[model samples]
Target: MNSKSRVVVWSTGGVGSIAIDAIRHRPDLELVGVWVHSADKVGRDAGELAGGTALGIAATDDAEALIGLRPDCVVYAASGPERDAGAVPDYLRLLGEGINVVSTSSTSLVYPPSYFHPEWRKQLESAAEAGGASFYASGVFPGFGSDQLALLLATQSKTIRTLTVREIALNDHYPVADVMMDGMGFGRPLEFEPMLSTPGFIEMAWSAPIQLIAKALGAQVLQIRGSLDRRVTDRDLEVAFGTIAAGTCGAVCTRAAGVVDGREAIVVEHIIRMARDVAPDWKTSDSDATYQVDIDGDPDIHCSLTLGDAEGHGAGRGAMAATAMRVVNAVPYVVDAAPGLLSSLDLPITLPRNVLE
Candidate 1:
């Protein structure tokens, strides 16, 4: 709605690259500038990083320079340690400059701020208010998969007693390395911290999801519980993506339970691991990957949902790009949204018309 119709991309990593490919193919959205933290990538063509023909959008390490341009929006895909620290400043700068933003920086931030760093959340809120813009964080799994699944289940009946969502992903090697290597309990034994302590890693990163579903059901959440379990191996082996390096075989399961008005009404579970020739469990291990969701309500009513096969990133680059694409695509609508700490629940689920296939 700014009429500028230009969008900037920050970073060009796994998710960032995907977002670039998605943006490059769109006619309505212009790829104006690219921000890179690594000095090596600066001055490089953004199109090359995205595996496309050069588009003349050179990468720069300067955020202030990009902010000065005042693009309509920025799609943030930057992550890692820098995300919590340096990324915040960039976000604030863009917001303070009155540029609308949509990002996957902290995918779950679009939800409630209870589980997140309070200081960071407040900073974002302040930036948005000062600049008269909107911000949202989104991703493929939590933003839509488990969180939305629960919300959809709650709608089937008026006497819903309990809600449960279970996801089985035996092909997500990237997340395993991410959680094990960079996650809180990596070097230390799992017993030391437990899954509950690292809900930010294992379970959905956003606390707003539980709160959102509870509110939608006309109830207030009283408590939340989480647990994590990992399947270990002694020898390294190569899987679909790459080598597992022995010692890290099997799966990681994270479970979160939410109590509404002193009663357990929500249970969210996620399982990510390497599944090759055989299923981890004897009963089900015939396929490379399988995703399913089960929601139970009063009278044992259950809705079984399953996602069809998706190679590599599970929906591939398109699905990965969709996470950021949908967010940036929603900038125009979000700018017109009511101010305050907004929730993904507050945004529309449909993709905008301008985005491409």
Candidate 2:
């Protein structure tokens, strides 16, 4: 009981809330503090903010207050559009304070070697080394779906020809209007360029996983490319976020391909639909959240992973829970690892521990 790692939830937002509950359920973790952005959440119990009973761990806007607790790890889940502008400084602060940070915030940090900001990486490295702490980045899509699972599936092969990880998600139940409607351009016209369609956006958000995979396989990435294909709704469609009017985009197929040895050998493809049947021509499956990994080699292999709630619905919600737990599960490993910016490749298998019901 005395040896359990002390944990601080950096934000009680989307994944942060789930992370708190996950930490509370873990026998090896003791939740000591919660940091929230919203002023209204300042005095609320962490459990109430996480949509549960009172946990007695009140939320605070003061980051330094949380730091005063001297937690072993901080689940930095605060996220936004300006990720590079926001998450980096927070990571530096936590790492410099000798606190291990496991986050789902920055996709660039998924594999820091390929990060766009070399200078920032250097600072992060220096901070971690100075404070003797480790920083890790991971989450559902850019994380497990795009990187680890495909890399694991490749172990079944002797010689690899091509590897691909595809996310076929029915986003109808995903309630984030900003991400689905504005960011992904689901309800926007073809002329509209949503956040995901912008040039260099996909590469910025997903290239890390490609580079990670390419590096792990002893392959060099000469170029990373991105492309987008959209499907318009023939009729008005209603979704969890809102309605997609007829003639607007209802689904999208976004691909980030890593060119290795003059071929797109490593690829991360996302086929997100406003509804299950929106993109019938695509690999729309029965499940809401399904990840498909395809490897072509001496012996080909294909795998499908799905996530769902207990009631068999809200696959998106289940994905949120999974994302939180993934990083929560990694807290112990990150704390135990050598002080540096650690990637999934750096750590042993971070299995779920002491959470079995």
Per-prediction TM-score to the true structure, in the order listed: 0.83, 0.95
lDDT tens digits by residue: candidate 2, 186-269:
899989988888889888778789999988899999888999999998888888787889999999999998998788899889
| Candidate whose TM-score is highest | 2
Residue 214 local lDDT, model 1: 70
Query: Which is the leading candidate under lDDT?
Result: 2
Residue-level lDDT tens digits of model 1 in 91-160 = 7878888887777776557574554678888888898889887777666556665566566655667677
Candidate 2, residue 7: lDDT: 96
**Cand. 2 TM to true fold:** 0.95
Q: What TM value does model 1 have?
A: 0.83
Error of 2 at 162 (Å): 0.9
Error of 1 at 286 (Å): 6.5
Query: Model 2, poorest ten-residue lDDT window?
Result: 309-318
> Scored by CA lDDT, what does every candidate get?
0.64, 0.87
